[model samples]
Target: KTTNMPERPFDSENARKKQHAEQSNNELDENSPTNNNEQSGDEEDDDENQIKGNEEEDYQEDDDEETPDFTDDEYGSEFTDDYLCPELMAERPQEHESLNNVIIVDNLPKVDPAKLEKLKEVISKVYNKFGVCRNVYYPLDKDGKTKGYGFFEFQNEQMALEAVKQTDGYRLDKNHTFSVTLMSEFERLTQVPSEATDIGNLLSWLTEPDAVDQFAVQSDDPKKTMIYSNALSQPILLEERSKWTETDFVWSPKGTYLASFHEKGIALWGGKEFRQVQRFAHTGGVQHIDFSPCERYLVTTSARPGNSEAFIIWDVITGQKKRSFPVEQGSPYFK
Candidate 1:
């Protein structure tokens, strides 16, 4: 009856335990005169015999203690307590680990010793038609039979999806149907619950969609102007970069450019590189600056004790000064 159920990683360990129990009972029955065969002397069978012995030892139950019950109160809710493993209704996944680019294939027809070897050889070539396979795994029971399932890890996610889409319904043989899904699909607890962000998951935070836009926090104590993402999506550091004497940082009206003031001039910057885009040279930095509402004009002004004060307007994109007005140093008429 269990043969009809597809083999899934979620229920694998439980199925093994149930099968081993049944096998053990069969072994006890065989101990009667009907199973008095001599131990094999063939060296090739040694590994298989050893594996079987190990499995028997692992399943042996101690007479004194009771096995624990599967319940949400004890284990936490993740997989469905019902249909996830149809045949093994009470079974549960041992762990939930996502093998990102890997996929599981199952429901191959059971074959004899000779046919099983042929199936393993052909199945690999069949999967490889879609993409490069990084690794393959097929475990055999003690009897050396193909357990009707295999796992193929591809070089990338695209290859895995191609394999699944291309072969999902095709039959491996007349007796069984093929089943395929990402290894993540079997994981009952794919997400790790966390109370706060820490080193373990910090790298993932940097890749969030909001991490690209930037802002700045300027201060003299740090000696450096700190440029950071306006979204606070990543760590921003100003460090020791105190070079600008200008009191304010001006962003162009459209925000396509950020202007920094220094004793020499006003410099415009933009892009992912955050490099200086253009410089408007001034002997003494501007006292105030503003971008026209349409962002086509950049206006700069200077206030000084000398007889000459200056107000200039320039083309914002070309950095070409279009006009300049000289004002008397103490011009109360301008205020």
Candidate 2:
């Protein structure tokens, strides 16, 4: 049954004709005259057409080579925001006299020793756009390679911050990038804090009575103040406040008198052995004390429960009461 029907033969002649038609269409010029009445293209037009075709091919080829984003890993991200240092976004200083305002820039373009000054000038000028730049530092080796980084000290922290935010991943030239961070971060990560021993050396002999004088009073510490006592022949602890002290302990202007608070009142201590000088008595205890500018007068305030607060001014030299004033509880010192 399968052999009963004859197979249809393939059409080779029709296929060849169809192929020839497609070739003819591909060769036709887009701007050429479609009808016989229209003008035909010349040799000059053919040359222009070839040039336009080459330009379009090159445009297509460049799409493969262009960078999408510098921050992407495709761009070797060293100079990109993705690779920025963590210290760059550090918190502000927690204390005064801190070196937090300094910005440490790293991984910069390395230049020859002779070109460092020129490079420094360029870097300074660039960072100045962000804030008031105090100084710029470029550390170099013997060969003068920029250690590949530098430091920028802004007049204040805000300027340093502006530079970090605006120019973090900013491309500096073609190869170099910035790694901006705090100088304190660098020191803390790389080294221990340096210490000064000069202070301890100067006060080494303070344990003797004759060397006694200036002392620091701490309200929170066990002993309100520390001073040299000749009796024990060593630094001795005195004026220990057994109860929780609410007021601060202060020293006289000339360091002659150490004033501390207690359950009784404010006790002023003086002498080589840190003897008791005088006690300004208050019924409930003194909460605060202030010495006049010349140390001739002292003012003490005691605020007790249920009754009016009382303030007394005392003559420092004779310990005589100068004035007494009473005011409402929780009221600030009378004007």
Candidate 3:
């Protein structure tokens, strides 16, 4: 107190040392057992935030990869709007509804089911002679017996008729004979006749529409009188002129011309004349004669016992001899 001492200025080194010591003390406090719980809590909060961010990223990826459902009716409704319509779905049928162009043979002799395949082969060969490939339907009954009939569908009506005329009553395998006729669609028609009940409506319904219109029984006697309805005023009369066993006869394509043949030569008649147009000579008895489709030629066949078997082709307009083909010895006699 007696001596005057100089006043000590603030020492910066001491202040720095005090600050460093306080920071070290704070760090030690955080590492202490009591503060460990608070430190772990902060670390857990950080981890939770990181996990939440990862979960959000996963959810976005899934949304991008997902596919839309297409099987639902709403999807179909939208898809069809631009591409499909009712008209496109529905298709129109063809004008010609006939199943085939050829003839169908419905009558065949009943045979053993075991021999069905052989029977079909024989029938096919007979059809081929008329220049046609046929489709045959042979169905069997429960007892494995042939129902005594089959169906043959051909490619052309002319060919079919030719086959029917040729092979009808034809003998196959020495024992079996067949009766053939045109197949009828009466079974498929809704309307039926009363007499059709006898033959199960198949035959009655199947009467040819054009045939019914053209031909009618004017008299009850089928063999004696038939009044044919023609487009002209004068109806034709099919009279049995001669008793020489006349089986079939047809008028020429033109109503002006008529032809009837017998064991004698071809007898040509006309609308104007009861006399013959031309008495053409054939080798044997004439079996069949047909006018060519173009009306230019006439085809005539003759069946004799041994030597006079021949088919003659003639010029229709001039009645001149065109050519002749010799038939084989055992060839069938067909008209």
TM per prediction = 0.33, 0.30, 0.29
Q: Which of 1 and 2 is ahead in lDDT? A: 1
Runs in model 3 deviating more than 4 A are 1-227, 230-245, 273-275, 329-335
lDDT of 2 by residue, 257-301 (tens): 678777777877665445566677766777778888787888888
The candidates, ranked best first by lDDT, are 1, 2, 3
The lDDT for every candidate, in the order shown, is 0.69, 0.67, 0.62
Q: Which stretches of candidate 2 lie over 4 Å from their true place?
A: 1-213, 217-224, 228-247, 306-309
Cα displacement (angstroms), candidate 1, residue 183, comes to: 78
Candidate 1, residues 165-244, lDDT tens digits: the string is 88888776677778888887765535554443222321232454865545577777655577765555446642224664
Best by TM-score: 1
Report how far off residue 92 is in candidate 2 (Å).
Answer: 84
